[model samples]
Each structure stands twice: as C-alpha cells, then as structure tokens.
Target: MKKLLILGLLFSTGLFQACTVNENPQPITNELLAEVFEVKADFTPGNSFRNYYNLSPVIFDSDVLLVYEFVGLDKTGADIWKPLPQIYTSDNGIHQYNFDFTKLDFSIFLDANFDRMRLNNSWRLGKTFRVVIVPGKFAKMVDKNNLQNVMNTLKLTESSVVDLTI
Candidate 1:
C-alpha cells in the first residue's frame, strides 16, 4: 500500500507539472478564426433544374433564396478553415460550394485529410421560405455518421428572413 501510494503521488505530481494552464490565455479573435463560406441557392423555376447536372440534384424547390454559412474548427475549438471571397453558382438549382482555404489570404489550422464541414449560419427570404439540411454524400466524410444528425445537433434549420430588392 505504501509503495502504491508513493508511485501514484509521484505520477500525479509530474502530470500536473507538465499540464500547466496558460497564465495569460490569448483570446481567439475573428482574425485568428477563418471566414465562413456562404452558399446561396436560388429556387427559380426555370433556372433551378439546370445547375443540377454538374454537381448534385435539387431535392427541394421554392420561390426563394436559401443561404448557408459554414467554417471549419479543430477539436479544441480553434478555427481551422478560411472562407472564400466569391460565391459559386450553378446553372441548375442543386448547387454545392465550399470554403476554399487555399484561396483565402490567411493561414489554415487543419490539413487536407480532415474534410469535416459544418453550417454555422443560415437564412431565407420569400413568401414562404423554409431552410433544411438534407443528408447527402458529405455525411460520410463528416465526423458524425449521419449528416442529418449533425444538422439536427447544430440546429441548422434555425433561420431568419431578410429583405431583398426585386
């Protein structure tokens, strides 16, 4: 018992010494974090079905614009991805885009292997607009098994209406 107690005490002391908290913890400012990419989808009847062939198909459609924002983060909550400046468009309604970290004029935290992406913000505007994140191929690459699960966990459906000029 005496030997065990001594060994445990020595191990604990060494562990505590090695893991010291930062006395002056640096704040994670917006500059340190990467910009979030904003994806916009226009649900116009004529043009909606056109852009679908190149990327993914448009599963749902309404007379509205659906916008979603997302950024990458590390396990410890550090920003790992940067947002791209220009928004991408598709001829068909079903369009997909990502935050190109390489194009952003900032340093990235995560490498290429970690393809996990998320929707941090979303919004819609129309007579009756509703935004939803449907499970797609991106789910398999996410940390969670289900893409819908991540959307539900993050509450991606929560959205706001914006005023737009016709």
Candidate 2:
C-alpha cells in the first residue's frame, strides 16, 4: 500500500509540474501586425515621371500593403479616404492613380490615356495618402477595398496613424 501511494503521489506531482504555466513569459511582439502611416506627395517633378517611396521599416514578404488617398471632404465636413487605383474622367482624359509595392518600397503614379503631363493639379499635387501594413495572417479576413472595413478589423483609428508626411 505504501509503495502504491508513493508512486501515485510522484505521478501526480509530475503531471502538475508539467501543466504549470510560465509566469514571467516574454511579451509576444509582432510590430508588423497592423501599422498605419499618413504620407503626403506633392508629385511635382515626379508627376512628370516615375517615383517610388520607400517604406521606413521594411515589411515581410508575407505582409500586405494597403494604400488610401484623401479625396475630399464630405457633406458632414468629415474627410473622405478612398482606396487607391482611383480613376478620374474629365476633358483632359481618363486619369488613374495607381500604386505598386514590394517588401522594401511602394510607389504611386499617374496613369492616363492622354498625356501624363496634362493631368490637373487636383489629381497630381498635394495628395495625402494612408498606407497600412497588415500582417499576412489577417490578409484573407480583411476587405482590402473598403477602407472602413480594414480600419475596423485592424482596430486602427486616426490616433494610431503615424504621420510620415512630416
């Protein structure tokens, strides 16, 4: 009986020790989880040609980049943010604001059916853009087209935005 009791106690002790959780665990840091940046482009000299903007902290190849351009104010006096690949039509021609990104950098350019130089200042100059870095883990869950949806899912707000424009 004594031998059995000792063996049972030993087994119980080992099991409990194995199940113990680490109390002073290191923090789980994923800096690229969801980061926001506000960038401004004048598109002066680059407007006539091609230009690329480098992302400050390089992102992982698995990460996703989302870009939004500030279009204008709404009726409620609130600023409107529109997703990129935006197209504009006017007398000048059909103009598009498109962008491409790699793990190291991202670039925005004006694409038009007409002369690129003919694009109006409104379409080229003084543009504010929001760049969001989302971890690839959440890529499938996010609606990339809807800015509001992306912001909501990532729990990001204007307060969380880092102003790279300055």
Candidate 3:
C-alpha cells in the first residue's frame, strides 16, 4: 500500500512538472490580407518641348510592376477622359527615375492632332498623377495600362477620395 501510494504521488508530480503555461504571451493581431503598395509621382514643369518628372514606388514588392499614366481630357473640347501612354518601372523600393518629356510617345494613346508634346506648357501644369501596382504574373497575362485589369489583379475592395486642396 505504501509503495503504490508513492508511485502514484511520483506520477502525479511528473505530470505536474510536464505541464506548461505560456509566459509573456502576445495577443494576435489581425491585419488586412491583401497586396498593397505606396505610389508617388512628382510633376515638374520644364519647357514647352520637354519636361522632367520623378516617378517612384515608395512601398512595393519585387514581384510587382508599377504603371504610371498621364490622365487628362481626351481633347480640347471633349468631355471624355484619355489615359495617355503608360510608363512602367521595376519594383525597386523608393527608387526614382527621370524620364525625358521629349521621349513621350502618344501615337496609340492620343487622337491625331492632339499634341502631347505641348503638355509641358504652363497651362498643363499642376497635374496630379496616379500609380497602380500589379503582380508580375498579371503583368505578363494582362495589359498593365488597363486600369480595370490592374484593379482585378490588385483585388480592390474599396476606395475613397479626399480633396486636400479644399
């Protein structure tokens, strides 16, 4: 009877020693699960025939591509919008590139006689641009210049607009 009691006590002691309690436990945090990016573009007025601008991806993954577009009216007297030729940049974080405004080609994006070269003039100043990030896989499968396709790839859930100028 004494031996059995000692063995039971030892077994209970072992079980108690084997138990564990978490220490300094950190609470689990839930963040939105999605592909995200931070985009930036600086439009600087240069000359009538050319301009200089800085384009960059502030926060993005290497497997993604950044598409920059020039958005404005389709024509001088038209209400329609036209997305000008798209410029693509790699996924280097916070890397800025200077593109010669003189090299801008609008053969496909603009209507005939819509002079894109003149966009560097003072009248065309203060234009705010946008950037869209797309997966490299989508870059190969879809046209990055198309906003719809980029939205699809980004899995856009919601969007909001804010007017800071006001």
The whole-model lDDT of each prediction reads 0.31, 0.80, 0.38
Please report how far candidate 1 places residue 108 from its true position, in Å: 29
Model 3, which residues run further than 4 Å from truth? 1-42, 45-61, 73-123, 157-166
RMSD of each: 17.9, 5.0, 12.2
Off by over 4 Å in 1: 31-45, 49-166
Q: What is the lDDT of residue 89 in candidate 3?
A: 32
Ranking by lDDT: 2, 3, 1
Top candidate, metric TM-score: 2
Write candidate 1's Cα lDDT for 1-166 as tens digits.
9999999999999999999787998765422221112223333334421112111232322211122333445689743322222143333222233221111121111112212122112311121111222233333433343323444443442232222222
User: Which lDDT tens digits does candidate 2 get at residues 4-68?
Assistant: 99999999999998897879998644444788888777655544544577876788899989989
- CA lDDT for candidate 1: 0.31
Q: What's the TM for model 2?
A: 0.76
Superposition TM-score, candidate 3 onto the true structure = 0.35
- Model 2 CA deviation exceeding 4 Å by range: 1-32, 45-49
- Give all TM-scores, in the order shown: 0.22, 0.76, 0.35
Q: What TM-score quantifies how close candidate 1 is to the native fold?
A: 0.22
